[model samples]
Target: MTVAPGPADHAELQRQLPGLGQAPGPVDAAVPAAHALLVHPRARQAIVLGGLNIGYELVRVRRRSIGMVVTAEGLSVRAPRWVGLGDIEAALQAKARWLLGKLGEQGERQRRLAAGRIDWVDGACLPYLGETLVLRLDPQQRGLALREAAAGDTPPGRRLLLGLPPQADAVQVRDAVQSWLMKEARRVFLERLAHYAPTLGVQVRRLALSSAQTRWGSASADGSIRLNWRLIHFSLATLDYVVVHELAHLRHMDHSPRFWDVVRDVLPDFDQARAALRDPVLPAFD
Candidate 1:
């Protein structure tokens, strides 16, 4: 899952627009055009900033200040009910540079994600544990078996010999792969959690797979852990960082310096692994 920047920081927004109460004025025409355009499906207002035509969604809320968010799609503005459109546009002009940068980053990130989407079919390839796993449809196989090639095979790595026939449809292949991946994810998670728990001196009471959209892993105060199964697609080192991070929470619930010290105690070079996990080009199962 590629995680884009969430929202414009309120402090940054405040700094950009020192005074939101300024009277509305005509948009400056002196700014040269860039021939860029961004539009939101629900946009109710439009503005030209830095020569980029932006159609943004405007939502009136009972707030004291205006908020701006640039997502993969486009921009959205939440403004106080008393604020007029002119004032909102003025606020936008004030933060145009920051907004445009975020929009460009998100747009490119989304493009990369789309390009990396998986195609469910015979001989299709997907990343598994930092290596490419080729899918092979073999009806004779029982369930899903991981088979290695004897020396030199055309498509290397390992074959996930699925039980489905060669004629299986895309949906069947996707579901079968997902089911197997979830089971394998649980088995691997348990082993890794046990491997690190004794060192961290934390007893994990329960573990479950999470399908959260925005979160990768979460730890509960009650000794329960929930990890995203999709993480199985990454390398073991990357997965261990998340495991160690959550376990460190057992001693200190907050991410204080002491919590980081606990994590570093186990994996001295956890930062490298953490950076790898942030790579946005993961295989999209959906």
Candidate 2:
């Protein structure tokens, strides 16, 4: 986090805003509603952009440039210590369109998270490998298991049965299902690594399952690979894309163009798989 030159202080930042010294407008029925559109309902800071209000959280730190990030929480602005409020506000205004679009995307992502959350009860539906599976209590000694949907049923797919009873709590259900998914992730990742290692002429020594929140997979120079177990929820093509990506890293050790060329040799349609990995809404688990 290096500091760069910016306006003198917060005063300058406020002055730089389009409407600093202007008088306040009258309160009308549309006033609250109109202001609502400009600001995020939960944002900590608000600014006027194109005569519209846009809300974001401003985090000042020792950084080189004013960086903006839009996540599940919302838009966040990071600025250098030396940067004045005016410079930060100006930058935000310049990127208003991108900011608004990202805000909308985060809203959509939040909606999907709500909609996709598993109920963790009998007859609950959960997503499995690009498909939906029904949850049923099968409290036999077998514990947790996935079974094919009954033949000729209306919504033809698979059913996952948990050994727990109908009265089982959410934590019990989530942990049991997660355990099974992780086991499958290890087996499937190993097979994919083995399948691509030979084609890429790279030898991977081990496969480690990762519960990392952000990183999907990483390859070390020592031929060890760590992949997120949540990947089991996605289709095989997405899984293979991550596998090839890490294996390619073994050859180049960096994300240079040549490294991607090696990946292209293995999976030609890598872009689609990459995009697929970025956009899906996974179930919420603590």
Candidate 3:
């Protein structure tokens, strides 16, 4: 249970715990009184209640919102400062069905992510830039490296080699690959931003990677852009499209037609990338 400091932090707090601060007011008195608590499949015991509302408590510090968040650590709820303990319990009880459903979905997502683990050995299939890349390890190769070869470029009777150290484990391989992809993503994203900035006549002040589960990306009025690092799993074209989408927001804060027009002007085929981004599999990573 954490409390945010100062009035300025209220908005930030509210964003985390949706409906806690600016909630639609209490449910009708006839909604029935009940006690509710967060139960995480990963937790050893049920989390104790802290506030009066239908909200769950989230424990992650970097998690800025107060609403429910499903994580490896467990379920968390962000309660508003003025909420009463009884009211919170009642709200949780009333919303038990919704919370349970969310928990199940999150649990499944976590399972899938764990299931997708790579063996880091020869013949492992890994996702790369929206496509699956097969690893072909060569023990004879002297050092660690990644080599991209055309599917058919291999010798008539020989397979292409993807040089990964023999001693590397799954976790190490995943990290190495992710680091390479992120570096490339940053480079390509910055280049695309620069390319479109001049055309849109806007300058980006800051850019950072985001791990947000609910949003693919977000842009602030202050010219800051936050893009999901998982986006590197998609194609370069799709990544560029998201960048353009956020950059356009600098000119038009809302998703109005004018804002879309700005995106279209820069990326005429933005629809393809948009469709690709809608893949339900992309959000599997929590």
Candidate 4:
């Protein structure tokens, strides 16, 4: 099974995966019970063809057969302009079993992603280098700082003192924290790059921070590396996987066997570090 990003809105989702959209099955009553209606804003027709209570977005396009795409926004169907509403409903009935299963998976994924979004206000907490850090609004603080929080004799977590107002809105708090995170990303990225470059027998010409939406990091044919600033949200081990990954590309451009060999040579536990990236649900920026 594969997971995809949640839809931006009711109508912003597009088909990405190839075979995930094509499901062949006879209608079954095993569809899970849905709690609420999931409707696309632009839907022309609605139906409860399957046991699932969600309504699919029926769209008429220039096509010969009906096509179904399950997105984070629910179900969307594309059919020939000539296809009648009855025929479209019948098509959904035929693929009900497969459709319901995929929708359930996507719905759960979206819920987790939604929960992971940061509120970005005073007292909001977030993960830094695999540890919990409470966000404290400190407008008088001269710079971004971290202080240990001790409750009695036991320390439960750390506090990140940001230079922001106590009544700062979400946007203001988000900007201040993000700016500090990017700076730390740059400083940490260079340190790891320098640590592994000589051992990997590679010379890194330059290192830069990237804010790419989908990519973690990239290695160009040139000896430059670009790592996402968001990586600072994860652990040092998780961040090193991407850093060492891009550095390994300096030796092998493609993901051939030689590439894994190079990555394993330095970061012996690289696979474990790579898995950490997915185990944690990152804070949503927007």
Per-candidate TM equals 0.73, 0.72, 0.52, 0.81
| Per-prediction backbone clash count | 0, 4, 19, 0
Task: Pick the TM-score winner.
Answer: 4
Worst 10 residues of 4 by lDDT: 9-18
Q: Give the whole-model CA lDDT for all candidates, comma-separated.
A: 0.81, 0.76, 0.62, 0.76
**CA lDDT for candidate 4:** 0.76
Off by over 4 Å in 2: 1-100
Pairs in clash, predicted candidate 1 = none
Better of 1 and 2 by TM-score: 1
Candidate number achieving the greatest lDDT relative to the actual structure: 1
Candidate 4: the clashing residue pairs are none
Q: Residue by residue across 129-208, what tens digits does model 4's lDDT show?
A: 78888888888987779899967623357988988788888997888788888898899899999998899889999888
| Ranking of candidates on TM-score, top first | 4, 1, 2, 3
Where model 3 places Cα greater than 4 Å from the true spot, the runs are 1-117, 136-145, 150-164, 282-286
Cα lDDT tens digits, model 2, 96-174, are 6666666666666677778878778878776677788787887673777777878786566798878888898988888
> Of the pair 1 and 3, which is ahead by TM-score?
1
**Which lDDT value does model 3 have at 242?**
90
CA lDDT, candidate 4, residue 275 = 80
lDDT computed for candidate 2: 0.76
**Candidate 1, residues 4-54: lDDT per residue as tens digits?**
222453444456577554654444555433233458889888987776778
